[model samples]
Target: MRITLKCLLMSCSLLIAVDASAQIPTLAKCTRSANLLACVDADGNAYSVNTVGSTIYLRGFEVIGKRYWAQTSSRYGQLTFFTGLASDGEAWVGYSRRVGWTTINRFSSSGGSSAKFTCSRIAGC
Candidate 1:
């Protein structure tokens, strides 16, 4: 009984860790491509992105390499964007747009680049 309980606890902890990993997003990353800055999905698909210094800004993201998406800390109270996503040698960026300010929370590494991103100007955010 004791061993089974310990195993259950360990499995539960591992599950939590997995869930934590899933929460990360990759809106930023370094790429070997041109155009100075780029964002990539975890599978290795790369997209051009705009960055300032160390942080990827709210703008400069393009979908299908055309329409650009952007956000600003001042203008929009809340915002959300894509990060690199990779799995099994495939890369893609799942996109979402949210705007409004809200509380910033801790970020995870494997959560993807945008996982460390911010959203401001939330309605109740």
Candidate 2:
């Protein structure tokens, strides 16, 4: 019984660590420029987002390539949803923002990826 309990605890701890690792880090900082919102994630990834009328334009600078997505926003009460396709039309990206929390989702042939972050504003960029 004792050995079994120890193994179970170890398995639980390993599962918790794996689950935490799968979570994406929040955006570290953000700044506004006119209609554009620029931010950097805790992982040092950079993003530029702009909204004009109902359309949302997102640009991301990743380690390998630059990605651009253009989506439209729909508002339900205080929540706004942005959904659209990538520049090349090979994938789709969606974003939802409520209050100061934002969730981003990307769907592609490989799989779907997601991240959650707090939308924090900083002065002096």
Candidate 3:
């Protein structure tokens, strides 16, 4: 009985781990072997960046992506961004194929580009 219980617990843990990894948004071509060029801000919210060697992590309390891009905040009329698009003209593009390491500013319907830095390690590069 104990062995069976242990097996079940192990299975559960494995399942949880898989789910957690999927929860975070990651780039396809952003392989660890590649070099991390840039790390963007997270929608004016809390975010952290820890880089060791060539691994850069853009961790947030409720944020996940290859990178983050911070923008104007809006409690009642502020802007924000989700996994894909920006809420009210805000976005955090961590890893992109065509653009490479870039943080596009989406302040409005016409979000301008502050900079479009490229990362050689990225897939497209």
Candidate 4:
């Protein structure tokens, strides 16, 4: 009877630990594709984003990629215009306040070049 009681207690403790772990907050994720940034919160809400230096700003619902640059920061490469209310959303973009940049392949407006890429996500939403 003592052995059975000990096993029951152990099982209960394990279950409680698992439940507590699940309750912990998880890191957010952000995916970058060409000129667009899509961030998903821990609760799974999607939003558009823009990054300048180490700061990320949440933008409108949709982003239009007029052009993309390769292997360079957007600030130096070209002028990017963002339209819509700048609001703070739940999602975070790539290690908040860290210096990181992504390059986008931009083709000439005349369709002279075509750069194709699939969207990929990185941690720290």
Q: List the residue pairs that clash in candidate 2.
A: none
Put the candidates in TM-score order, highest first. Answer: 2, 4, 1, 3
lDDT of 3 by residue, 32-117 (tens): 33333232222222333334543334332223333333322211122222122333344333222222343222211233322223
Candidate 1 structure quality by residue, lDDT tens digits, 30-93: 5543324444444343334344443343323222333333321111323223333223222223
Q: Give residue 38's error in model 3 in angstroms.
A: 15
Estimate candidate 2's RMSD in Å.
14.0
Give per-residue CA lDDT, model 2, range 8-51, as digits (tens).
12221111111245565343478888888776655555556676
Q: Best lDDT goes to which candidate?
A: 2
lDDT of 4 by residue, 1-125 (tens): 11111111222111111113476755547777754666544544345545557333443222222221211112333323211121222211111111334322222222222232221135211
Highest TM-score model number: 2
For each candidate, C-alpha RMSD in Å? 15.7, 14.0, 19.7, 21.4
Question: 1 or 4: which has the higher TM-score?
Answer: 4
Candidate 3 lands at a TM-score of 0.19
Off by over 4 Å in 2: 1-19, 22-26, 64-89, 93-125
